[model samples]
Target: MTTVDPTYAACPVPLPESERVLLGHGAGGQLSADLVTGLLLPALGSAAPAGPLEDAAVVPVGGVDVVISTDAYVVSPLFFPGGDIGCLAVHGTVNDLAMRAATPVALALAYVVEEGFPLADLRRVAASAGRAAAAAGVAVVCGDTKVVGRGAADGLYVVSTGIGHRPPGAAPSAGAVVSGDVVLLSGPIGSHGTAILSVREGLGFDADIASDTRPLHRLVAAMTAAGGTGVHALRDPTRGGLASALNEIAAASGVPVEIDEAALPVPPAVAAACEILGLDPAHVANEGCLVAFVAPERADEVLTAMRGLPEGGGAVRIGTVADHGEPGRVTVRTAVGSRRVLDMLVGEQLPRIC
Candidate 1:
């Protein structure tokens, strides 16, 4: 069981009243915490926040624990078909901490605005964030704002951080993955990537493509409750998508992975976009989906639990973990039943599409 260090203080940094967040706020160092406790928390309330003050926050809840995570929003074209960057940011960080089987608790937001940005747009984004947080059953406890010189910053960028508690007896980590573990995907992938690409490229399609951005913490909690310790590792297929995420897990666990291409889920619109762009859906990023690694005996249970969630309604067991037949290698069985190497993403495919 992980224990919080007794020496850890509720507010490690000196509290101060600041009107705006400086670039130092994003450093992920001492200054960041100072900004949170000193300004954000007091404004929100005196109640102490949870989570490790690191990238995300972890809090204790009942006998089981929870964790909170936060992230910034700077994706261009703040508005998208399925959702906006505002909602995307909330879900992104929430899902990150949820991958640890932690129940998300609260979120804090910070927005940087260009001097001439429309107030209506700002209100829309803020409202979206609040609604999204509420839908996930997490509160928006604190926030900050800053206005930059016109043309100096994008229209607006939002940074949201959350705190959650990890349940007792849950051992979620990439390192826990072992040979014979099965790999599972929460649902159809590449929707977010394709949606972003379509908007950016002005590609008109008969199908309306939208981002798959939504909170996944509840789904993760369900899977853990159902499978218990069998859920070895969980990772959201984000920035670099499934291929990159799988490579990281395989390398970290010193295990080889094999995914069946035919079993992989890809929505029809996403498949069409990938075909037109010569992009592999596996290499495309997803905002509201996750990849889970589970012990073989409990894989079905975990998959069932995931499928029961709205976000994971299409969950599928796609592959298995194995002793590295070739160290650091990830292979995929193609549609034709032939194996092919899946390499890490070398460079950006759609830069800033996140």
Candidate 2:
């Protein structure tokens, strides 16, 4: 019997030339995308996953659809203006479940602490997380904590898992996203990334900007009630911003998406900061915004429902799923009347931006 290398035996496409993982690999950009499509999928032998991998994995047992999702938070400077890592972890998990139109019921939390970390800080983080979960009406049923060497871990990092029940008559999935569906965006973009950067860089813009970190489960319920099954897919533009989220949905749904630049709802502070820092607002990270793919007929209703919510006041219809099939691509129509391919960032523009 001969033993063969897994790369050569099972890989469908050639692996990347690089051997080491960089910060960009974790940026949720093109490199991250390649890692999934090129390496992980082949290694798992799950080229054909049950569905296009979205925010959460939906499992059906005993005729009940269960939504499960996990997320990790390592944003530098654990505390920011609008949120800290604690609230971020809870919000992230809750949003993931909500992406699939699921109602969050419970959460599990795990924390990694560096040596010499203050107990008071730990207590504060825990308290914040508890408050967030409580506000979302989700219980933190179980939790764990671990300590590592000073150099082994950052000050602190949080990992959270959420469980939710899929709503009846709601079948939201990336695969369900079809061409001609209206693309909607919830609130302004790039605030979270800009806020983090401003604090770290000592750059103060006119209006105080903060992370838009919050749970969207309630807003999701409003959409379901208004749009019913018209809501096709939902994506939280987190690590790689709105551009990456749209691209992911396009690739997963096997269709092209077109975005309108003039319609983007970028807050003034965020836009000015991005311009000064030479950052593309589209590629910046956002914690509390989401991209919605909805049927054209119900698009207005869903948009109205979102606008009525406090967390979704800035919701706007931004683009449309292209009718022509040019899958795995996104195009943006500029205010100047030109179109450009909205390619995923080859490397991270901002590392650990989430």
Candidate 3:
């Protein structure tokens, strides 16, 4: 007779009926969400906190709130069209802090390297990290390095942590989102995800396509300065793309979101690449773009402020909050007079994408 564990019976987010983890666990899709809500949070206990973890955690530091965030980078191709894993690590952590109107003050990093890795490559990656932190005006206050036996690890992997201070009177939270708010997308989508895929799969779209991986703290600052408290929520559509970002906001705020497909600002090259791969550009990841929920009255001013910045030059109002619809629902108004429910990715579309 075979014995089965009864623990699986009470799982909230359905797993794949497997006893071990899958690649989907790290895809930042449905499986990732399930892992948190089902296992991690429960282990943390009922008094831990409400809801799953957001990009960054805001902790009260006596006089003010300090935001801290961290992320790891293991992209196969260390060097990509627009960035390397080192810079990606920096920008990712910095952007997480910026999303909550936090200004980064310092960063810490750790590197796990494979034995026999070239010293030249390590030096190059380290130099890039330093330059990125300096350019972002944040100091790298601490670091650690370790090496593993050959084949035990990838060429290199980076883990980074960021510390920042929330701007006074600036509160960008998912719970702050409300009906009658405006939705703004900072720029074109799918550039970063597609750029990496093009390199990994040897896709021929290299002549012009590249990842839009750059620091977004400055852009967030500009929007906050213009809209002040009018800006309710801010998120950078990264790992799970635009669809996941909007769905998260809707659920967190208990509001309905409607975006126009025709209004989506996808670059021509990115759209072509996505169509060829049977991927929706909106579902593809981005490293530099952001989604903002703002008061309707200040939407125009915020849009203008974003447009004035180089990174947000392609900013546009893609949708609005709705009064009636399924709560926590996201719908896309198709160009041909139809509506499509935009659901969170149930399975991995692109693996190791971010």
Candidate 4:
């Protein structure tokens, strides 16, 4: 007999219901989709008419393929050192579309304000969102506003939706990955996670630890320009970090992934924070970094292109995909020459990590 951990049962989001809001409803899975389709879409009038709403909605406009993705921001402690929730929301959605090799075009903003929330803070958050969008060269076209009862809502949450045009002949997906493909990391990992944890736990570090949240469409564009079709898959190791992202690609491509532990780039501050908190840096979150899988032949070219971009200055090849007899097996080569399996996060090691 097996016993389920009661702690896992205590989810952060509500469950799905006809009228009631549950934490599970925001899980980004089936229940979340149901909430959007069954309630929110109906009430707001279906802005997206297409049936299958994916990570991004693809639309054909004037012979160009446009991809759009939207996400909400409710991170506790509205402001952090490197970024605020508002800027994070913008980067999150824009990066999602960029992962598809799309050039970001426009953005839509939505605000849900709780009663008693300071007007000054709200204005600041909005300004941050606008500035982030502008910095990314994306426009804020439209939006909506809502107010909830004081006790029923958090201080302020911003939801941003972004649209971008996919470059011609660009194919981006885990399915595009093939054996012997090289895996690359844009920069050091675990910064965002450590920053959040530091603030939440009040862990004072010697250096300023801040969230590494920024838009990556420009970097993606540069890589695409260099390697084009040779770049197989691009993922922004956001929620589950590099380990989970690589595992996902391996599973989807039916390939084996091998990573070198010594090659992984982790900031010292981030490593220290992870050690103190008993967290694996590989499984920590990153907002500004990306993991790109490219053909081994073009890996160097891709690296050169990435290094030219401001966001990918520390880009390095960390691993490769190959046949390991069994499909979807991921192994990490330790510094001592030992190998270990890298498995999917069985359960939430850290919740609300994204």
Candidate 4 displacement at residue 111 in angstroms: 1.4
Candidate 4 least-lDDT 10 residues: 1-10
Question: In each prediction, how many residue pairs overlap at the backbone (N, C-alpha, C within less than 3 A)?
Answer: 18, 0, 0, 6
**lDDT by residue for model 3 (212-320), tens:** 9889999989999999999999888887788878888888787899999998998898988898888888778898999999999999999999999999999999999
lDDT of 1 by residue, 62-141 (tens): 75456656566667678877888788878887887888777777788899999989999999999898889988888888
Comparing 1 and 2 on TM-score, the stronger one:
2
Could you give me the TM-score of model 4 versus the true structure? 0.84
Q: Could you tell which candidate, 3 or 4, scores higher by lDDT?
A: 3
Please give the lDDT score at residue 265 for candidate 1.
88
Which residue pairs show collisions in model 3?
none
TM-score-based ranking, best first?
Answer: 3, 2, 4, 1
Candidate 4: tens digits of C-alpha lDDT, residues 188-234: 99998788878878898525688999999899988988888998988
The list of candidate 3 runs beyond 4 A from truth reads 1-18, 46-52
The residue-level lDDT of candidate 4 at 19 comes to 64
What lDDT score belongs to each candidate, Candidate 1 first?
0.75, 0.84, 0.83, 0.77
Better of 2 and 3 by TM-score: 3
Between candidates 3 and 4, which one is better according to TM-score? 3
**TM-scores of all models?**
0.81, 0.93, 0.94, 0.84
lDDT of 2 by residue, 146-208 (tens): 999996777998999999999688777776888789999999999999999888777885247
